[model samples]
Target: MDEIIDFESLKLHTAAGYIRASNRCFTCKAKRQHCDYKYPVCSNCAKNNTDCMAWAKGSKSPIPRSIACYLEKRVAQLELEAHRLRTELNPEHLDDKENIAANLSSKPFSGVCNSEKDDIGDESFGFLYFRSSNLPAPFDCTLHSSDRGNIRTFMARNPMVDIYSIPSKIADIILQNYLDIHLPQYPIVSSEYVRELKSSVFEKRNTCGPYEKAVMGIILAMSTATLSYKGEKGALASSGALFSYFLSQILQVEWSDKLKKLQILLLVAHYAFSNPYAADSCYAMKEALRISVEMGLHKELDFDHISPLIMQTRRRLFMVCMNMARHVFSVNKRMFPIPSELISFQLPEAVDDHYITDSGIDLSGPPTKAAAIHFYRFRLYETEIYDVLWGHKSIKCGLKEWVQKMSNNLDSWLSEANHFSTINQLKYRAICHASGHVRLYSRSPRKQWRNREDALLLMESVIKCLDEYLVNASTGWLAYLMAGVFHVEELTVCLLDIMWNESNWIFDHYSQAYISTQVIQCIGLLQQFSLRWPDIEKSKMVSYLSNLHLKITSQLEHGFVIDPHIISQLNFLIFPQVSTGYGLDSLPEDTVDLDHNFIQMQQWNDNFTSSLSIL
Candidate 1:
């Protein structure tokens, strides 16, 4: 027993020494080991600027409390520094490239503005691309199983949607991808997806059957509703009312009604996604409202059973009508002169269902409620696309003619000399001119005339009116960008026409010619607006011009080479006027007349005609 106790005491002493030795800095701890001695640190630690704490024979270094704490604090600081460096390197911070890189070698906080956003985490999660020009198969395949769980799982893995974020030019690619990739095996969308869409409508309702029933009614209505039909007349009144209800909900901004309608439409789309006109419910709803409005059905529609899909359909239709009205106003303002005394028409009872409040409220009072109805009416007008460059040429022409006739004697009607004039009266002159020009331009070239000076005056007036209107009216009232783009186009086209025709004649007249050339250059900047918005039809026109340009250059180089003698004679006829002012002898006195222009114009016209004949 005494011998065992002595052995235990010796083992305890050896353990205590081992722990003490392990707890020292490298130089102190490796006293027995072969760590090279150096001043202030071990040779390895001196080179590294750190205490060597790596594992040694038989054990990891038992770091000293003071030294361990100091090292821990330093490690934390270094980790923070490294994190900042990595952040600077990350592509997510590209928006702050100039600042991030400048401070990269410097301290994180130095020279960096506190207000700067250093990090912008990804919000879009993911997206796919399909270029507009690419010819690819459509990806329209679905998951093989119709089970709700399986379909939801598949969508979670790879959600399908229209590429609305991309340019519409590339929308075709997305559509094609959908057709090719997902449509084959997974043809039918599960009913569960359709049911999921039900949430977009009718949230507070106690029951939701009327909502679905209303949706079905709208689908049947869209397929069968007609203007002459009335419910009592046995002409599918349910469908017409459904159509009317949808339009009213949209125009009135009835969100509850819209959601209900949306669910029905989604179900329709789900069932008939492959149908060409499956998604046309909105279009039909739009048509219904437009026709109703045209017929002046102010209060003759019902909306109690409006569905969500029908509501969307009506909204789209309302937008289309507004767009049409805008096109009319923009292309030819005279056709839709902001009316002075707009006739107040009573809408039929069917059209009177208010989506904004309890349907029980009576609105049969005087024109006091006129302001309320008028507010929604203006929305119909506001959706007018101001920058669209392509549409019905014939309609635009007709509109131009209408404006011309309406504003024929504007001086008599709009003269400031009238003592009877009010503030609005004085404003009508500018309004009339602006609206007239917009309407005129919306039409065909048949209405196009050579009155560049008059058009310029109208365009200038428009700019002035727009400026003043911005100051006086509410911010949301004026379409500043639209007005600017339109004014730019108007001013530019006038200048371009002048420059194109008068370049050769006035090119040498430095003062006048310089002005003309400068105008042409200015027009180039305005033309850039064409690229800011998307319009397939207008884009096609631009593409056509580009192609034609190449074709013309090719032809000019290889074909239709001019005779040297003709060129010389032409120079003699035209160059003298430019160089020595001698060609003034050849120009006719009646140069301002059409006859003079005809002779010069014939050259280009003949070229075009010849080209067409050859083709």
Candidate 2:
């Protein structure tokens, strides 16, 4: 065999054998190319700048039965030991017992996966996975993770000043303003509580704890800030200083007392809604919901065993919590934190504060009906509608059927509104009707006559609502507060959307003018709102409306017979682009002139393209 064999031939033979062996790395395999059989990494993988994974010999062949069985047994034993150790280390790791039960009821795994013949895994693993799926998502997990660090930093940087520096008479006046204006609408705290705080603060009594004082201070600050105008600059400054002081104090508390913390949060959230610092209201609502859940307010309780006063208090707190959650969700378009299915409590009884006493509620007392109860019920119905509109449930019916059902429900709700005779009730009913119209319009086909009619009607109703609110504002504070929080921004958005529907053949010059005028009216109302609450951050909404207005007006200026293509191309040029820093003061100067040449060129190109198409 020592016969002379050529070296080149031998090397070629070896390479051919290697290629036939199919021992390429993962990258080469994926690329479907021949590998150099290099150690660590193949040549093709290296050249291509990819990770190379070596394939094991005979990996495609199934393992022997004996070895597979042994491996499976070993894995099972390891998993069991790990689970046991975990259980020992943290016995209460699965503390959400109700959630577990719900999961088990909803998603029970068949025993086939882990029958006597095959031991796949423990049931706990499946439950754990299911629970994880049901847990609150990142955006929805607003409670557990808050802006406490930021708040702390703010407090550290801005040292609080003495709130008592304001004149006692002015302070009392502010407190009374809040009670008269905001209390009728909110009623989160009892009048007795306010009176007590007022007496203590006026007398300079230290009987009130820091938390109570903080609550009172923030209430007064919110009231003063909302009711006052630019003319009362000094009072506004004092209110701001008082708010910071109280907020700093409130931030220092550990928030261990659930009820007290909830009360404080509600007041803060209300203030935030009225002030420039409205962004934190969602976080406050989330925290409030968390506290309500912890206190078992969502769950139905045995009223017979509990005191009537405590029961009523719990119901009222839960309802308020729901209202706040609904408001935040509606505005942000975020997933609601509290599921309605989980709520088992009933609506709060329509009773006056005098019916409640230190001993207990006077259950035998005559039910002094109030508009607030109707308001609460309306909010509850609103929440249900919101859930149906936005929730993940599958609707088997057609759009018309769904719309009809919802409309019927809304009509039923309105029918009951006649029973409530107060001005607030009338206003609330009008708002509800306006909201229903908007909701229906939102869900309906965009180009339909019904949708356009709904949009027009909504704008009209909203205008009326605004007019009534503004007129009533002169009479009391509730109207002003309601107007401040009213969903005018929503109406503005709807009007803009209607204008943007270029597909609607029905859209004409008159329609454009009318919609544009309505939009301006809405913006004008918002401007009035900004005037009323100058410190509040409404520039964003105002800026958006302004930009929309500019767009609509520009379209109108161009006339309707112009080529749609040219209009489409020139649209961006007509309106000044808004930035995130958009404000009344920071608005960009008109750029229509700067883009004149560009628009002319676009028009020329459009004419050229149209001529070519004709040819």
- For lDDT, the strongest prediction is 2
Candidate 1 lDDT by residue in tens digits, 1-615: 112113343344346553222333544465556555332245566566665542224443333322222322343345345434444444565456333323322332212222232322111100010001100000001111011111112233323321123354332332333223221112112122223323323332344344443442333333332211233123223322343343222223223332233333332322121111112212222222223232222221235665433332334333333323333233222122122122232321212222222334244632222222232233233222222222222334454354454445343333432322331112223443444444333222333343544444443443443444443222221112233333434443333333333333433432443444344433333343233222212223233223323333343346445335333322332221123323212232212311122223222233222211110
- Could you list the CA RMSD of all candidates, in the order they appear? 29.9, 19.8
**Which runs in model 2 stand beyond 4 Å of their true positions?**
1-89, 92-173, 225-239, 276-279, 358-360, 363-369, 392-429, 443-456, 465-486, 502-511, 525-545, 556-615
* lDDT, candidate 2, 525-598, per-residue tens: 66665543432232244664586568656765676444454333223211112122222333322212111221
C-alpha local distance difference test of each model: 0.30, 0.50
lDDT score for residue 38 of model 2 = 62
Error of 1 at 456 (Å): 4.6
Q: Considering only N, C-alpha and C atoms within 3 Å, which residue pairs clash in candidate 2?
A: none
